[model samples]
Target: MAKLFPFLQIHDFLSDKLSKEILDYAEARQADFSPSTTSSGGGMAMVTNQRISMTLKDLAEFGPAIRENILAIAPGIIEQLKISPFEIGEIELQLAAHGDGALFVTHIDTGVHEKSEKPRIISLVYYMHTQPKKFSGGHLRMHTLPIGEDDVQPVDITPDHNSLIAFPSFAPHEVLPVVAPNVAFKDWRFAVNCWIHRA
Candidate 1:
């Protein structure tokens, strides 16, 4: 767990116009988002008090595009992360938004409790928010191996708009608290969570 892992980050993953369009689309579906949940390592998902955020299971306008791009670049991502190549399985996509006082504690993407048809291999998060961003904080902190609340080495990312990042699913990471003041959900920190699975 102490091994130094590799991560991929690309800026300007989409055009400004497209980024704005995605944000608008998300804002329009505020009602569709529900409280994010965590797995109990058994076979069931549980509502937790640790992570605070909202998520939408689908994003019709751009889900396909994101999937296509991820699939196209996944091999490079895995090679960069020094993982063995596997046939891509389902790509799980979830739209997430975090407003004031929201944060997700450190956790890995691999199932903490159970197994699946296709285990997650890589995790990608595409950040999107209004220009002249209305939110503060919400930084993504990827912990270097051997991490803990007391002693740890971490890399903090700003979650720049239209930027995308990828990392191994087993790496531990967390989102810092967000401060959006009085802005609406549309102005909150937005991200598309994608999981590349092994077939």
Candidate 2:
């Protein structure tokens, strides 16, 4: 299990103040949200109905902090995965909003496209949400690939505010369906999704 599904979870990755600030910025910029597509380059019809977008200039303040934090603990993650450290180039930051009933089916972050040259070595997700917890059941599930006809087991990680989760890009994972009874966009589950690529 250790070799097949290596993952790291860091609690309180950001202060309450900073976390709120980021969430506020996202809410204000919600108009820019676009339908997220599958790694296969397909349209929304092929995947779930969550909205996503690259960080805009307004989110510049978070770039350095996020990159530095990830790099600070990256050595440990690489050691656990037993992979050679590759130059971390072009850290992609994506803001994703999962509203009520939003869900993403299981998928591996790497190797979705056969002709792609750059490979994503590591995937990271920083979770944030409004206070009072208007939503429920938005967990990140990492599944173990069956070994020679063995049954797969899933590890569920709750989406707590200001927490960061990282795993190998090749690991299959999915975001469980969100249950936002209130159904307000402001109360939706938000995540700062990041991918570190080999150069």
Candidate 3:
């Protein structure tokens, strides 16, 4: 079997106060939320769900600190993954809120845009949620790429508040369906999705 590196999960990636501020900011921008699409040219074959996202420009000053943190850790991540060292390029940021029954089917972040000159090389997700959390079943499941006849089991990473998870962009993964019993959009599963590209 091909060697598989575990996804890195850092606890307390951001303080409670800062995480709350980010969540509140996203909540205020509810107007921006819409059904998310997958693949290039607005294809929706791979992912089916109600979701929203904001770019770094959309975030403006609200995003620099998070961006800096990701950049600061890029060197260590690259070394661990044993990939060619790369300078950070454009970062795609999105505030993904999963309401009741929201889910993203398994897929890789890279190779979705076959024609694009620049592709995402690293995928990072920062989990944020309020105290006494309001949602359940939004764990991230990453599958192992089996090399032969042996079956590889997937790893489940719970969406812990204020935690950050990172892996290669090409890793196959999915967000298991979220069950928000109360069904409040504001109380749904929230994550700051970031894709770092090679410069």
Tell me how far the alpha carbon of residue 65 in candidate 2 is from the true structure, in angstroms, after superposition.
2.6
lDDT of 3: 0.76
Instruction: Give the candidate number with the greatest TM-score.
Output: 1
Query: Which candidate's lDDT is highest?
Result: 1
- Name the runs in model 3 displaced over 4 angstroms: 1-3, 40-57, 111-116, 148-152
- TM-score of each prediction: 0.91, 0.83, 0.85
Q: For residues 1-199, what per-residue lDDT tens digits would candidate 1 score against the true structure?
A: 3444678899988778878888998999999999998774645666686789999987996888889888888878889989898888888888999999989998989852134566888999999998788989999898887643444357898899999999999988999999888988888999999888887
Clashes of 2: 0
lDDT tens readout by residue for model 3, 1-199: 6445457888998867788888888778777776666664455444334322222226645688788878888898777766788877777776677777878778888843234456788899999877788878989998888675655578899999999999999888888888887766667788888888876
Off by over 4 Å in 1: 112-116, 147-152
What is the descending lDDT order?
A: 1, 2, 3
lDDT of 2 by residue, 1-199 (tens): 3324778888998878888888887888878876676546443333334422223333567777777878888788788766687876666677888877778877888742223456789999999988888889979999887555545468999998899998999888888888876667778888888878776
**Where is model 1 poorest over a 10-residue stretch in terms of lDDT?**
111-120
Global lDDT scores for all candidate models: 0.85, 0.77, 0.76
